[model samples]
Target chain A: MKIAIIQFGGSNCDMDVLHIFKDILNVNAELVWYKNKDLSGYDGVVLPGGFSYGDYLRSGAIASRTPIMDSVKKIANEGKPVLGICNGFQILTEASLLDGALMTNSYPKFICDWTYLKVENNNTIFTSRFNEGEVIKIPVAHKEGNYYNTPERLNELNNNHQVAFRYVNQKGHLTNESNPNGSVENIAGITNSKGNVLGLMPHPERAAESILGSKDGLKLFLSMVDYFSNE
Target chain B: MEYYAEVTVQLKDGMLDPEGSTIKRALEHLGYSPKDVKSAKKFIITIESESIDKAKDTVDEMCRRLIANPVIHDYSIIMREA
Candidate 1:
């Protein structure tokens, strides 16, 4: 499956994401800068993690207004898969591609640590390889990762099963200690109403290899490849 | 004419204010009353314009587009008429 990763001016993870797709997954992947509007050939697109525009106004606030996001939004509306990680998640929120917004962490400090995430909804293409309630360890590094949504939207996410991941303890049980950024209901990731777009705060690319600590993140990338291969 | 505008943006009440909480603690340590202190960002902009309406519109646009993320921040503009 061919994948296109969007790279904005301040994007730092485009290379890492491309490397994993090329070397590890052995999939055809290319880095498309923010200025490029052509994305007709790729099977999927990824908004990789980084402090786009230095997180000056707010994380992903500036990057969302870049010219390429318009096309990304168009591609997403067509039922293609779009995965956003870290600041990419923030960008999705800013662009209104995903529901809710990410606020500063309750801790009020930059948090950089390994976090355990529970697979809340494995039925989606992004988590099809994992079982429901499965615990996966991934690294999270961000100052503004706290997710917030209105009451109606939160209920909608629950009823629609749009929540993809939640913070969990080492025993795979949801707990406050495992809530790295104080996200409401310990939410760590969510999908759009159509389930075609995914936004997650953790860095799955950072954990794609066992050398980085765990290979659990590989399942996500593999799931995407598997999904596109079947199509 | 040169007009100076100061924009102050703050988190709405009932929202978690980690930065304000941190600053409040620091003030308490400094032996100030520190009863209630909220933190907000201030932006000072100087614009040359021919009319007040034009300057206000331009600064308002800047606030919405760059100075603040409307999702979280509420900003008030204070313009100094020259």
Candidate 2:
């Protein structure tokens, strides 16, 4: 399947995402500049991580208003799969593609390290490869990764099974210590109401290759491939 | 005539307050009572308009579209004729 990795100004992980799609998954992928409006040819879109707009006026605040985001919204509305990683997740929140806002970490520090993520809902196209409650290791790096949603909205997300991942301890138990940013309910990733769009504060592209220390993140990409291939 | 509009945006209750908590800690260290203190942001805009209604409309639009994220932040706009 052809995947489009969106490249916005200051997007640092676009190349890494592209390489994972091309070199690892052997899928047809291309980098789509943020100014491009046409996304008709691509089956899926990936918003990779980085300090978009240098994180000047809040993380992802300025990048969310880029011209290409209109097309991104259109594609997402069409039920095509879309994944936002790290700063891309922040942009998705800023763009209202997903619910809730990512705020400063409760600890007030930028955290960067491999974090254990529990797969909360594996039925979605993004996490179908993993079983529910299974823990996966991925790297998270962000200062504003704490997810904040109203109690009513959080309840709705829980009822709809929209929560995708939760930080977990090494023993596979969910704990506060596992939460890198003190996100609500230890949430690390979530999906839109339609379940077609997902946003996670982890750097899956950074761990797609075993040579990079681990290949656990490859399953996420492979799961997306399986999703489109089955359609 | 010149009019001033005050817009205050605050996070909804029950939402985590990392920034506010940080300030509270700093204030506590300074030997001040910072308990139950919540932080908010405000924007004061001065505009030249013919009528108060026109100024209110303009500032309301700004608050709705730019100053606040309706999903998380609630804002109040107050106008004062200058």
Candidate 3:
């Protein structure tokens, strides 16, 4: 399946994700510039991480308003898979494609470290390869990754099984120490109610190779491929 | 009419302001007792419209659409003749 990895200005991780998709996953993936608004040809889209627009105004504010997001949204609404990572997740929230917002971390420091993610739901196309409650290693690097939403809305997300992943400890337990960012409910990722769109703060692309410390991230991309193949 | 609209965007009440809290702690270390702290952003925008009411509407829409994220922020706009 052909995947469009949309690249915005200042997006540094575009190449890395492109390499993973092409070299590791053996998939046909291309780096599509943000100005290229046509995504109809691609089977899936990925918004890679970086300081788009130099993170002016907010982490993903300026980039979310760009013309390319319209095409991204159009494809997402068509039930095509869309994966947003790190700053990409911020853009999805800013674009209102996903629920909640990624706010400044509670420590208010630029955090770069590895984190354990407990797969809260595995029913989606993005997580079908994983088992519910399975824990995986991923890396996160950002200053604004604290996910926030109103209490009622959070409950709605939980009830709807939209929370796809959450921060956890080695023993698969949720704790304050495990929560690198003070996200409400220690959330690290979430999916849209339809389960076609997934957004997360961690850099799964960085962890896709064993040499990079973990190959746990490969399953996420593989899951998408499996979905497309099944269709 | 040319109008200047000053928009203030702040996190909604009960939302934690980590930067503000860190600053508050620093102030305490300096022997100053502070109840709490909050951080906000201010944007001064100039808009040309037919009337003051229209200018207010434009500024308000800007805040709603761009300047503020309704999920966690509240914004206020003050319009005056430019």
Candidate 4:
């Protein structure tokens, strides 16, 4: 399946995503520059991490206005799987493709570490590889990964099962300290109402190999592969 | 006529502002009893317009379209002749 990795100016994780998908997963993935608006050939799309538009005004705020995002939105609307990681998550929210904004971390520092994620909903295309409530380790690197949404909206998201992942301890218990960012409800990852567009603060591509300290992330990518092959 | 539009964007009330809170804490540490600190962004844009009323409408539109995120931010626009 052909996958397009949208690359905006200052998007550093574009290469890493391409390498993981092309070299590791053997998926036909190409990096599409921000100005190239056409995205018809790609079956799936990924907006990986990095300080897009130099994180000016806000993380992903300026990048979201780039030309290529219009095509990305169209693909997402067509029910194609669109995954946004780190700054990519910020861009998705900024573009209104996803709900809520990622704010500065509560501690007010950039955090870079491995954290445990609990699979809150395994029924979606993005999390179907893992069982519900399963714990997986992934790396998170961002200054503004804290997710914020109105309390009413958070409840709505929960009722719809749009919340796909939540922060948890190694033992799989959700606690205040387990949350690296002060995101309400410890949200680590979430999906669109249609269950196609997925956004998360962690770098799943960085965790695709066991040599990188965790292989848990590969399952999610493999799940994407499974999702397209079945379609 | 040249009109200057100044836009101030702030987080919606009741939303948490970590950066603002951090600043509040720092002030408290320095013996200031500031109960809260809310941060906002200001953008000034100069444009040609036929009238002040027309400029006001245009700047308001700009706020909705680009200067503010309606979901999390509330923005106000002020227009003045330049």
Candidate 5:
């Protein structure tokens, strides 16, 4: 399937994701810049993490208003899969494609480490390869990764099972120390109402290889391939 | 006429303001007791308009569209002759 790796002005992880898709996964992916609006040719889209626009104004505020974002929304409306990682997740929320806002970390510090994430739902194409309640290790690096929303909305999202991942300990327990950025209810990832749009705070692309200390992320990419391969 | 608009954007109440909390902690460590602290952004923009009424409207739109996100932020604007 053709996937578009969207790149913004200050996006540094664009090439990293491109390498994962092109070299590691051997999938057909292209880097589409923020200004390019035509996205009808691509089957899916990936918004990788980075400090876009130097994290100006807000984490993803400026980038969400870019020209290509309208196209990203268009494809998402067409039921195409869209994966957003870290700052990409911020952009998705800022664009109102997803719910909640990623606020500054509770400690107000930039944290970078491998975090354990429990697969909260395996029903979606993004997490179907993994078993329900499975735990995977992925790296997260950001200061504004703390997720926040109204209590009513958070309850609604949880009731709908839209929460895709949650921070947990190595033993798969939700402990206070396991939550690195103090995200609400230990939420690490979520999907939109349609389940075609996913926004995750961790960098799965950074952990897709064994040499990088984990291959857990490979299943996620493979799941994407498996999804369209069936179609 | 030229008007300068000053906009203050702040996180809404009941939202966790981590940056503000950190600052509050530092102040407490310095022996100052503060009930709480809230951080905000002040944006000053100069608008070219025919009247003060029009300048206020322009700055208000700018805050709504760009400077402030209605989801988590509330902003107020002040205008004066440049």
Candidate 6:
């Protein structure tokens, strides 16, 4: 299945994602500019991490309002897999495709480090390759990744099984010290209600190869491939 | 008529404000007895409309649609004739 990596001005991680899908995974992936509104030919879409629009007006606010996001929104409504990473996650929330808002980290510093993410839900198309409660190591690089939502909405997300991942320690125990961004409930990733749209702060593309510290992130892309193949 | 509007966008109360807290802490370190610090963004906008009410509507719509995210922010607008 062909995948489209949406590229906007200042999207720095497009090539890395392209490499993981094209050279490593042997999948057909192409970088599509944000001005292109047609995504009709792709089976899935990836919004790679970077400071879009120079992170002005808010992390992803300017990029989210671009015309191409309308096309992405339509693709999401059609139930195709849509994965957003780091600043991509910020864009998803700003576009209202995801549920929560990502604010400045509690520490208020740009954190670039490896993190452990517990797979809270394996039922989603993006997380199908992971087992429930599995802990995977991925690297996160961002200044604004603190996830927030109203208490009521947070509860609803939990009840609906939309939470896809949470920050945890090496032993997979959720602790305050492990929450790099101070996100509520240590949330690191979440999927839309239909399970087709997934957004997370971690850079899975950066962790796709064993040389990159861990290859645990490859399973996420593989899960997408399996999902599209079965469809 | 041309109207100008000033919009103040701030994080809703009870939401964590890391930047604000950091500033507050710095003020304390400088020996200033500041109880708290709140941060907000102010935008000056010009809208073309026929009446004050119409300008108000346009500015409000802009704030809701783009300038502010209702999930974590609250915004207020002050409009006047330009």
Q: What is the TM-score of each candidate against the true structure?
A: 0.92, 0.91, 0.98, 0.96, 0.96, 0.98
DockQ agreement of candidate 4 with the native complex: 0.68
Per-residue lDDT tens digits for candidate 1, residues B14-81, read 77888888888988888886677778889888999987778888999998876776666788998887
Report how far off residue A119 is in candidate 5 (Å): 0.6
User: Cα RMSD (Å) per model?
Assistant: 2.0, 2.2, 1.0, 1.3, 1.4, 0.8
Candidate 4, superposed: residue stretches over 4 Å from native: none
Give the per-residue lDDT digits (tens) of candidate 3, residues A1-231.
899999999898899989988998789999999988888889999999999999888889999999999999999999999999999999999999999999999988999999999999999999999998999999999999999998899999999999999999988999999999999999999999999999999998999988999999988988998998899
Q: Could you give me the TM-score of model 1 versus the true structure?
A: 0.92
Candidate 3 overall lDDT versus native: 0.93
Which ten residues in a row are the worst by lDDT in model 3 chain A? A17-26
Question: A154-203 in candidate 4: lDDT tens per residue?
Answer: 98999999999999999999999999989889999899999999999999
Tally clashing residue pairs in candidate 5: 0
The TM-score each candidate achieves on chain A is 0.98, 0.98, 0.99, 0.99, 0.98, 0.99
Stretches off by above 4 angstroms in model 6 are none
User: What tens digits encode model 2's per-residue C-alpha lDDT throughout A1-231?
Assistant: 788899888999999998999988889999998888888888889999999989864688788888788888998999999999999999999999999989889898998899998899999999888888888889999999999888899999999999999999987898888888989999999999899999999888888888888787898999999998899
lDDT of 6 at B67: 98
* Displacement of the residue B47 alpha carbon in candidate 3, Å: 0.7
lDDT (10s digit) by residue, model 1, range A1-231: 678999987889899899899999889999998889888887789999998989977789898888888888988999899999999999998888999889999998899999999999998879999989999999999999999887788999999999999999989888889998889999999999999899999999999998999989889998888898888
Q: Judged by DockQ, which candidate is best?
A: 6
| A221 Cα displacement, candidate 6 (Å) | 0.2
Q: Over the stretch B1-82, how does candidate 2's per-residue lDDT look in tens digits?
A: 8999999988778666778888888899999995576778888999999998999999999877667777667788899997
TM-score of 3: 0.98
Candidate 4: pairs in clash? none
Model 5 per-residue lDDT tens digits across residues A1-231: 899999988888999889988998789999998888999889999999999999999999999999899999999999999999999999999999999999889888899999999999998979989999999999999999998888899999999899999999999999889999889899999999999999999998989999999989888888888899998
DockQ, each predicted model:
0.57, 0.53, 0.89, 0.68, 0.68, 0.94
Q: What order do you get sorting by lDDT, best first?
A: 6, 3, 5, 4, 1, 2
lDDT of 2 at A9: 84
